[model samples]
Target: MHTDPDFSSRGRRLLCGTLAASVLPASLAPAAASAAAGNWPQKPLRLIVGFPPGSSPDMLARAVAEPLGQALGQPVIVDNKVGAAGSIGVASVARATDGYTIGLTGNGPLTTAKALTPSTPYDVARDLRPISLVATSPFVLAGSMAMPAADLRGFLEFAKAQGDKLSYGSIGPGSGSHLAMELLKTHTGIRAVHVPFPGFPQVATALMGKQIDLSFMIPSIAVPQAKNGRLRLYGVSTAAAFPGSGDVPPIQSALDRQRFDVASWNAVFGPASLPAPVAERLSQEIARILQTSEVKQRLLEQGWLAAGSAPGVLAHKIAEDTAMWGGVIRLTGARAE
Candidate 1:
């Protein structure tokens, strides 16, 4: 993807304008801001999502959009730009200097995309500003009923026995699910063919249909199916038991090996040069929203933990995950397909 020259110039101006505003008096600062502090959101806001509608990221975006809009005194619209493992939508938000165009994205495009494909258009640390860490969930390593693996240890043995004959499904290359599975393979020395799908629903469908033998599925999909006997769950990828998954222990308990804790997270971000007042107001508002009983209950029921973190927390997470997933990609030799 090529960088737009106009966007570069606008980004520079945005950065300079914000710097200039820092020295101005409170009464004069609003005039220098692109989206003035008093009336930052004079129009409807656009929350650009990278994944298709109904996916985890999309659902999370929709969950917060209305409430966030109410807080800002504006309507929030969700725009789906799906492609290149979610880089397209992320890049769109990166180039936007206005505060009205924000992004709701996960670790895939924000951390792993550039490492998997160096030609990726935007840099998370440079082009995007962290607003807050929204929510988080863990993945469950599930096996098909046909696999005959009653436990995590049994599943490992089954996988080793089948060797190259075993296959697993993932949402796509460079996704959290994909890297989590690869990390499992690295620890156990088990090998399997990878089948990439578009999203978790399709991966769940393929697992139930026996199109694939195993996969790392989110708890929302894995829990209900496991209860109904549609899928066999071996263990959870998180170090602790996932909320709403009853009686299921961490994977380490089943195999007596070290646990692998990898979580999938969704966060809010705006253009890197977004004004400090706008960023602070948005983050503080989101944190308050996530604390309400209604929002917390809704998220918990859907297998998500509402994590309304400070902007610095999200920035640190992005940097840490970028280095972590970079190693995983290098180990598995996964490239953008």
Candidate 2:
């Protein structure tokens, strides 16, 4: 899953000129001259989304693209390269020679995919530059109302009783839903089979068709179905109840103690070699856009919490989650087919 060990070495070399300028004397620095002449984003930029159109990542990508394009003064096109649990598109962005190419990634491909697919081509730490985190959506355990589970406790009991017969669907093999379910199974000692779909719609459809026992779905997709009596929500994956979903109880209340809280987050990322100035500019502009009342309202309507953090904070988050998921993956022994 890790890329060449020398990747960081080459990245360090590429950044050496910029790194030296800060320490060298003004009169003697060729680095400073080169940095001064470097104008980033002189052409159209491609924002690659690993998920298909209408997915959470795709929606957020479209939401931020206009403002990002305005700030960079270049077109920010969102290209959908959906496949391989998002590794297909992500690897494409990683291999692109153009600096303008970036990826709109989520928790799946950025962190969990590594553990799932050992031969994955891209390395998040070495290949991608972290930009601001756009938004976060918590997961919810949802089931068809025809089932006996009424809450998290009831769901666990029912799952235990069903044993190998019960099953759950997730976005893909290494998705947040799959990890959360794995953790739940480990904690509860339930033995539901893992069923993975290509995307959310298919999972939702399977639930509606009574083809699957349950699923961990995003609020935007699950909430509407729950309201229409198509799906019955058991509990949220978060430790506490979310803002809009008052009717749905938090999983913590049903279980004696909660062990997992997973959130599906979307963030903007570019090539690691992108200039610091350009990264800062993009971060600032995104922060401004998220701060606006209109944008905030739109995001709220979609069950997303606006998170406009600095580039450094975003990078730190990616690193922290990578380590966190590594432990979970090791514990569950989860892998892609």
lDDT score for candidate 1 against the true structure: 0.80
Error of 1 at 4 (Å): 30
- For every candidate in turn, the CA RMSD to the true structure comes to 6.3, 5.6
Q: Give me the displacement of residue 146 in model 1, in angstroms.
A: 2.7
TM-score (C-alpha, index-matched) for candidate 1? 0.84
lDDT of 2 at 303: 90
Give the range of the ten consecutive residues with the poorest summed lDDT in model 2. 13-22
In candidate 2, which residue pairs get closer than 3 Å at backbone N, Cα or C atoms, i.e. clash?
A: none
Clashes of each: 0, 0
- Model 1, residue 249: distance off in Å is 2.0
Best by TM-score: 1
Deviation (Å) of 229 in candidate 1: 1.2
What are the Cα lDDT values of the candidates?
A: 0.80, 0.75
Deviation from native of the Cα of residue 14 in model 2, angstroms: 17
